[model samples]
Target: MSAQLLERGALRYTPAGVPALDATLQHAASVVEDGRPRQISFEIKALGIGAITQALGALALGQEAEFSGFLGQTRNGRGLLFHITHLVAHPMPANAL
Candidate 1:
């Protein structure tokens, strides 16, 4: 997904001493849902672990990027977290279809 890094917490280490980063991603796009045009905008909590944590930690807030990852339950098991595994820094602007 293409998203903007809205906010991030200080870089922290996991219990096993592995790097971890917690962030929020904001996404906005237009799509067709149920045969009708729809505008979608939302913010999601995200996590970058291992080496990816360093890269994600280096980004400035509001930076746009292409993120590839999976969704999983948050630590508290009450919310979802986008587990970012790969990303392209400053992806090209989106083209209108």
Candidate 2:
């Protein structure tokens, strides 16, 4: 799904030395839910690991893109988090919505 890149924390590493980054995403869109169209908005915690982590670290603030990933609980907390496996740079105007 497409979302705005909200923030990226400093790069971190796993014990295996895999690069990783934590961040947040803000998504707002009109979607069909239960039949009718509805506007939805929410925030989600996100993660980028390996080479993707460095890629995410270079993104400019407010950049938007579509990402492919899975969801899971935070490493040491409670909340849904998106584990980004791949991303495509879209660069849409931040205020276009």
Candidate 3:
């Protein structure tokens, strides 16, 4: 999904000492719902592990990018977190250049 980086927590390490990062991502898009045009927006908690953590950390807050990952429960098992496995930054629009 394409999302904006909303918040980024300090980088930390897992129990085994693997790098980890937690962030909040916001996604907004328009879609057809029941043949009707609809707009949707929401925020989700995300995690970046290992090498992905470094890349995710490099992104500035509010930056937009495409992210690919799987969903899983947070460590506390009380919330969901997106485990980012791949990330691709969107190119800047020509007008912005």
Candidate 4:
């Protein structure tokens, strides 16, 4: 799904030596639910592992992109974590940033 990059944390390594990155993402979309158009927006906590950690850390704040991943619990079993495995940058309008 496509979403805006909200925040990114510093890259850190796991105990097993794999790189890890954590960030927050915001998603907004208009869809037809039950034959009615509606707007939906929400925020999710995201994570990238290994080589993807570097790429994720490079994304600018408010940048929009399509992310493919699954949802899981946080490391400490708090809120959900979006475990992003792939990302494709979406070109935005000149003023969209």
Candidate 5:
């Protein structure tokens, strides 16, 4: 029933070369039906490297970010969350500006 700081890490791209940001947010809450302890996990991603960096910076500063992620399920106790991801300023292509 208390707010818990989950996990934090730098954002990076996958094997496909797509940029992304990752995060895991954990929280403890009372069960809706059984009133037992519950845990939540949050995974976030960004489409571009710039956006992921910006978001990570914001999080480091302890600022509230608009990024999207997962919310704990009262029943299943797990869920998947997706974020639209933001681009920082103008995202330049791989070739050139």
Candidate 6:
């Protein structure tokens, strides 16, 4: 007799408010023995003080600005991992800061 199987999708969460820079700077890890489990980490880095200042200035002027990017990772089993980091930023309201 053949048995039927069911699969479930992954779950995710996004916290409200800005994340800490230090927390975002740390490396992350994951482990799995069954199925093809995947773990993803995300972070944002400001290119320079000028860029960040400009973004903040835009917010003060009642304009909105946004920056975004991605993070990549690969695993090969002998305790080694590879990753490509990325960052993004959005101007918050002057009062929000």
Scored against the true structure, residue 45 in model 1 reaches a CA lDDT of 97
Model 4 residue 2 CA deviation (Å) reads 0.1
Tens digit per residue, CA lDDT, model 1, 2-62 = 9999999988999999999999999999999999999999999999999998789877777
Candidate 2 — what's its lDDT? 0.87
Candidate order by lDDT, decreasing, is 3, 1, 4, 2, 5, 6
lDDT of 5 by residue, 1-97 (tens): 1222234556667777765655443333345547756655433322224445554544432223344433333224464443434422223235542
**Runs off by more than 4 Å, candidate 4:** none
Ranked by TM-score from best down, the candidates are: 4, 3, 1, 2, 5, 6
TM accuracy, model 2: 0.87
Ten-residue region with minimum lDDT total, candidate 1: 88-97
Per-residue lDDT of model 3, residues 1-97, tens digit only: 9999999999999999999999999999999999999999999999999999988998877878999999999889998999999898776556654
Q: Write the per-residue lDDT of candidate 4 for residues 1-97, one digit (tens) a residue.
A: 9999999998889999999999999999999999999999999999999877766887888989899999999879978999999998877679864
Clashing pairs in 4: none
Show where candidate 2 strays beyond 4 Å: 92-97
Model 6 spans > 4 angstroms off: 1-37, 42-45, 56-97
Off by over 4 Å in 1: 91-97
Note each model's CA RMSD in angstroms.
4.3, 2.7, 2.0, 1.5, 12.0, 17.2
Number of clashes recorded per candidate: 0, 0, 0, 0, 0, 0
Please provide, for model 2 over 1-97, each residue's C-alpha lDDT reduced to its tens digit, 9 standing for 90 to 100. Answer: 8888999899999999999899998899998989999999988889999989877887776788888999998878777889999888786675754
Candidate 3 lDDT at 15 equals: 92
Give candidate 1's total backbone clashes.
0
What TM-score, to 2 decimals, does candidate 6 have? Answer: 0.19
